[model samples]
Target: MSDSSFSGFVQSFKKLAVDTLSIREGSDPEATIEGIKKDMTFKGHAAWILIFSILIASIGLNSNSPAVIIGAMLISPLMGPILGIGTAIGIHDVDMMRRALKNIAIAVVISLVTSTLYFSISPITIEQSEILARTKPTILDVFVAMFGGFSGIIAGSRKEKSNVIPGVAIATALMPPLCTAGFGLATGTYKFFFGAFYLFFINSVFITLSTYIVVKYLRFPIKKFIDRSKYRRYRSLLIIFLTIIVMPSGVIFMNMIQETRFKIAVDNFINDNTVFQGSELLTQKIVYTDTLSTIDLYYMGKNIDENKIIFLNEMLARYGLNAKAGEYFPLTKKTLVRIHQEDGSGADIDKKFAEYSNDLHSKLLRDIYTKNDEVIRDKDLKIKLLEKRIYNLNASKKDPYPVQQLNKELKFQYPEVEKYAITSIQLQEFEGDSLKVIKHPVLLVKLSDTVTDEQRPEYLGKIEKWIRIRLNDPKLKVYKF
Candidate 1:
């Protein structure tokens, strides 16, 4: 293509794009705004559209359904008045601006009231992550609203066909804020209401400003407006100036303070806990999930003595942390003992166990199960072998057996005898008793809080040996978990 042809094509595209987006500035901007208000079928069409969209949004918020919320946003007629306001302000149309403001206020109040009423009567009390997530506003949110509004106006005012309106709807997220307003009402939370309303306010202001700029760029006739009053023009200028100068700075300052506080807390935690030499600090997750606060500190590597842990606890207590931390010790990594048994009973079992156990070494390393890459589930053959062990354990009531108190905290895969017999048994409290015969041989085991399925055998072996001595039956057979 020739240079002139390419230049002409570029000019044509620019003109088309400009004409599509720009609403021309006029002399009597107020009169133009009033004309728009008069033409808006508010009571008949716009009212119903607004109500329907708000209703959809309310339901989406209650259900925590993103798809439903997006649908509501797409159909919302509320954006029209907001854009009108922006357009009016940009071209100094005070009357249209006032009317648009009134409409927006009414729309917000109606949406909030209706949503609140619906949520209050609804039986759903579970607050979903989606609903909670939207309640907080940050600098990122402000930026999103501003850019989204800009894009929305550009897409909406275009003459040539494009699905830009939907994009605008998504970017603005008009429905969620209203739904959040409803959630506040339902839960009777002033914080929710405040945050949501502020978000709505931001979006409305940004959208209007964007629309006003676009309209001015389009050269909408200012002199053709209906409400040609001097006072209206002054009011429009004041509002437009204040919005341009004040809001963005305030939002930025608030976000900065919040981020600074969060960083301080994280840094303090890391600095305070760096003294433990043997233990490898895994993670410190400061999660803001529920309204309530919590901090989770995960530690891996070697176990220090109880004295060190107590000292650490004292340090944490200074920070007002009272939660009890848990500890875990894996035998393969933390201990020196390891025993392997051969399957054939006729073979030299003791010799084999000693030989296999002699190869064991203890290294200060993280437990394999704690890592993300570990696959710890038993194979089908192993599961079947375990089943066979339970089936093969044959001891009857005639055999001398021990009566031991079971811990109430432990849940058994098989039906626990305590569940059937000891309704008032104390949790974690076991009482030694006289030996008693059982229908079948039973295995007794103790569980550490952090033990995975793979580590069960070593711990169970000790328990099984203890139980054997307590029963006074060397021949009594049982499978340990």
Candidate 2:
């Protein structure tokens, strides 16, 4: 061979070798993985799987069913594209990476759109614990995705792999977040969208990277690969583009870490200083008001002490936080105390009533005063008439009429009465414009004996007005006979 021809031949051989290696390196492992993915026939299987999983997840979130949620996670088919992207990147196979990313994006958009469609018409609101839980991603979620991807790649590459795909699916939790994204989309909850989409983004990036690492480690080659200088430049540009795209996500990941830490600090402060020691704090919410800070902590019970407040204030001072702390005990519990006075008579009615009234007013939101200017005692009085055993006389309606609805307005009419227990309500059926009648026959209103019979009509008049307003009929009458 001539010198020129020999040199050309050597160059050609080198190019061939590189091309062969690129093709093998880029195409081999993915070929194996892709074969399995392809074997998943049943047209639109992925679409169907995604659709079903989202439905289950949405229902689970609405119903607060953890087991159903886990099942949905297992059935989700989202990891296939995510891992594909990672493998493509690691092996430096631009084409494969593009395909993988496309698939991933398509799957996500489909899942989210499907979920949004389902939730939009499902008649369920986005108020469940699981829905709220996934709406906020912590650093812990990133860690989970990273580990899950690492494990997923390992399992996907193995022959006769033990249900690792399912394990990976559960660990990565791709579906739940997408379902939550749907919830956010439908409910117009921007926070939910922010957190859930961040989580999905984290999983996509870390999983693809992990898959790349695994594919490289496996030495999978791209088949029929052709490398050109122009392609190299293009590849570099794509890498730079992807990096730029992900830069903002890194910022979000950092913010999530900081926010999580702040919440932990607040909880710790509440637990260490509050009277609710060893109690499970139900909810700890921090709100930044326009001019002040508000920290609302709801506990399981209503056990508070004054000393705890002082201690909490000190903690807030240390953090340079000025906030108001409010505690609500169980609705059933009353802190109001009533005092009674006997005016050389039966039960020191004046003095006792004055003490009780003062305690109630102090604990309640409003103050209570009487025209007589006499102090009233605080007592939970249940009228015997309200608790009377009355039978249902009218068979027109069901077993019992709405007694609670009937008596809600009783509060304003009978401020002197602390509580009323409805013993029975008489329902009468009429053929004319009268729909129904509710009679509270034996209501023994609790009042001081000092209250004259003439004053009784005023309270009764208020009760009558309340009933008239609730019935929405001016002619509807209550016969106290």
Candidate 3:
């Protein structure tokens, strides 16, 4: 193609891109700033709204209801003061900044008081998953807050506002974390309180930062200008404050990543090496920590020998879980392996079987069963077979006949009988043209010389009846010696 035609095509594409991406068209900066200022006051209606929203958010978190939490976020007046702070910073308006800060503090106090009261008096003390989720702030949450703030400010600056504000409110999730902090305070779980409060702080700061960026990009008119020296000082302080806020989240994200990798490695190790000749891995627990990690394996059917455990521990180095002596690497933290064996005893087997059966009946297992019904069925079959084998082995180890008890009872009933023995004997019989072997319970009794021959047959018949009744075996035989 000729240079002139190529240049024309490039210009056309650039024009289209600019037109599609531009935020300047139909912008209302003055109106947006005024709206933010108007919403910065925490008055009669706003204060009540904040209190009610906090209560709603707390209830939603306690109930573990995502939809309800989203609803509370949509109705919350929290974004107003936050947005006001950002706008004030953008325009260098000291008075507006003061008002925004004051209103935000009021909102925070009201939220905490309302949520704490509700959670304290409410009978539900359990920390639901929804509440627990907000207790940690990660780098991903920072991105969510920043992007949500950008969308919110851009949407607010438009001549025709859409539903972006409510969506942004849900995305940023400003209210739930505060409510979770209140829950922590009420429940006396300080870890939850600090973690949740830090999360809330992160969201607020990142949202404010994003708003300031967008406001500057949109070139909102400055209300006042400070001296250059004061500006530099404020900038330095802001950088330091942001660093403090963000460093912890960055560390948390790194830890989360490391934990995820460790779990994956552990899963691979378990799947590959957990199998033994006669043992079944019933359950496993993996605990990951910075200092030391641990893997606890629970086995059923047979006990894993010490040699195998030592070998498995040696294999930990392949998974990057075992550290060399004097090593100080982060991922090289030493992991301890503990193997708990059930030995397939009757009581232990029964307990583990009951636990597995209960798990199969649970809602989570039902959902998983829907996806892997065949695999679960196969596992169930294996468990049943193992249980049967264990039961059979246990039966063999136990005495089938209680000779001591039977001898005592016989001696008490018949004073002439000195002692007795019982056992299972195989007898051969001819049935038509085939020889068959049948097993039967046999009882042998030795009588005192005081008993004459005449009393022998009579005592033998009575003893046979008594033995049949006592042992509940109709096919038992009795003899006297």
Q: Write the per-residue lDDT of candidate 3 for residues 370-423, one digit (tens) a residue.
A: 434244424444445445545555555575776545555776688888877778
Worst lDDT window (10 residues) for model 3? 360-369
Query: Order of all candidates by TM-score, from best down to worst?
Result: 3, 2, 1
Q: What is the TM-score of candidate 2?
A: 0.52
| Model 2: ten consecutive residues of lowest lDDT | 329-338
- Candidate 3: give the clashing pairs: none
Segments in model 2 whose C-alpha atoms lie over 4 Å from true places: 1-31, 36-42, 90-102, 224-285, 288-292, 296-315, 319-481
Best of the candidates, TM-score? 3
Tens-place lDDT per residue, model 2, 11-86, is: 9999999886543333346545675345322238777887888889888877779899999988887777677666
Q: Estimate each model's TM-score.
A: 0.49, 0.52, 0.72
For model 1, how big is the CA root-mean-square deviation?
A: 19.5
What is candidate 1's local distance difference test score? 0.57
Output the number of the lDDT-best candidate. 3
